[model samples]
Target: MSSHSHHTIRQAILDRIQTGEWALGELIPGEAMLADEYGCARTTINRALQGLANDGVVIRKRKGGTRVCDMPVRQAKFNIPVVREQVEALGSVYRHQVTRRVEKAPPTAVQKRLGLAPGTKSLQLDTVHLADDRPFAFETRWVNTRAVPAILDAPLDEISANEWLVQTVPFSSGDVVFCAVNAGKDVAEALGAREGAAVFVIDRTTSLAGEFITTMQLYYREGYQLHSQL
Candidate 1:
């Protein structure tokens, strides 16, 4: 039999999750079992399951086994004001507009996030988050070119920089921070708010073995809320 790519395996796993075949809190079949069902090697199944766990879509543990989490971490963001859910919750159309995507030496902010010097090149993606044709947020993301060189050919607007990079590049560790801030002119304009307006700010930095992967800043309009319940 031909070897199956990890992407194929991942799609099959995602299908099972979406179809309710793998109910929340249910343990996934063992690697050997999955391999037999899919006619693939255990390695292929491992790659797919590992990726799902990294994306917070499922829970995987050595002894606990892989299981559908009753309250999946991915869904936790929905209770929060995720850009996608924020727009959808308002009963308006959600849209993403890429402002710019460029490769250049790291900016000051990038350096701060990655602990890089002045000469390191990184891919920068700037975008506006929209709802019903109105600007709602501004997203600025920087990816370490050394970590994910294929980012050069990736399309903007087709997918979020954060989502695409996360799937394409595997990072060992990362951190997300949320805060409240007063928006400046650029942020206010992009988010359609008055200058110095109150807004929610989210900053994320991801790395692998001390090597930087990406840093993202999300600025949301005032009144935005991020909630999570255990």
Candidate 2:
């Protein structure tokens, strides 16, 4: 397609790979050539190719160029879910409130994970997501204001940061971690569960290009199951 966006170009490349036009482990076209063919900027082609590389679809070398993966890896894909939609999808009314919002120095672990200098102030938000007037999840997050300065002007009191970030940021790649944890006091209080109760936790970090954006820990109400397709 002419003048196609990066996402469209990404899909087109995938289609070619699916139909065996691009053989496994074979080199693909360079960014300049793809840009000329698609009538889009070279940066668009680069972004599309970066997405494929993130998904393990292709390998790219700064000097050697790009190639289709000989053996594609199978991984479960999970898009960041909007909490309001998630609640409504479950046939429950969704309501949320920000319990805390402050700009403060994050923990050493958080700083290291984000590759930030020590004592960097990040926008920290603590919130409770409700379903049908009951607690659903508790979220603690750190926003990298350097990457997302708009978050400072966002009305956190009126909208959940979870929803706000999804609407405001365009992240290129992310990592998700799921685990089971015994609830601590703050999390138990937020979720209205007994202390020490088992809860599902999701830790997610997202970035655009090379800059880290945010990292968050979500503690779901006891017995919550994540249903996803592989």
Clashing pairs in 1: 25-68
TM-score of each: 0.63, 0.68
1-230 per-residue lDDT for model 2 (tens digits):
36678999887776665445676678999999989988889999999999988866678998999987654122215667778888899999999989889999999999977779999999999999999999999999999987777789888878889887765455556789999999999999999999999999999997654668899999999878887665
lDDT agreement with native, every candidate? 0.73, 0.82
The worst-scoring run of ten residues by lDDT in candidate 2 lies at 69-78
Q: Which stretches of candidate 2 lie over 4 Å from their true place?
A: 1-76
Regions of model 1 farther than 4 Å from truth: 1-82
> Candidate 2, after superposition: displacement of residue 177 in Å?
0.8
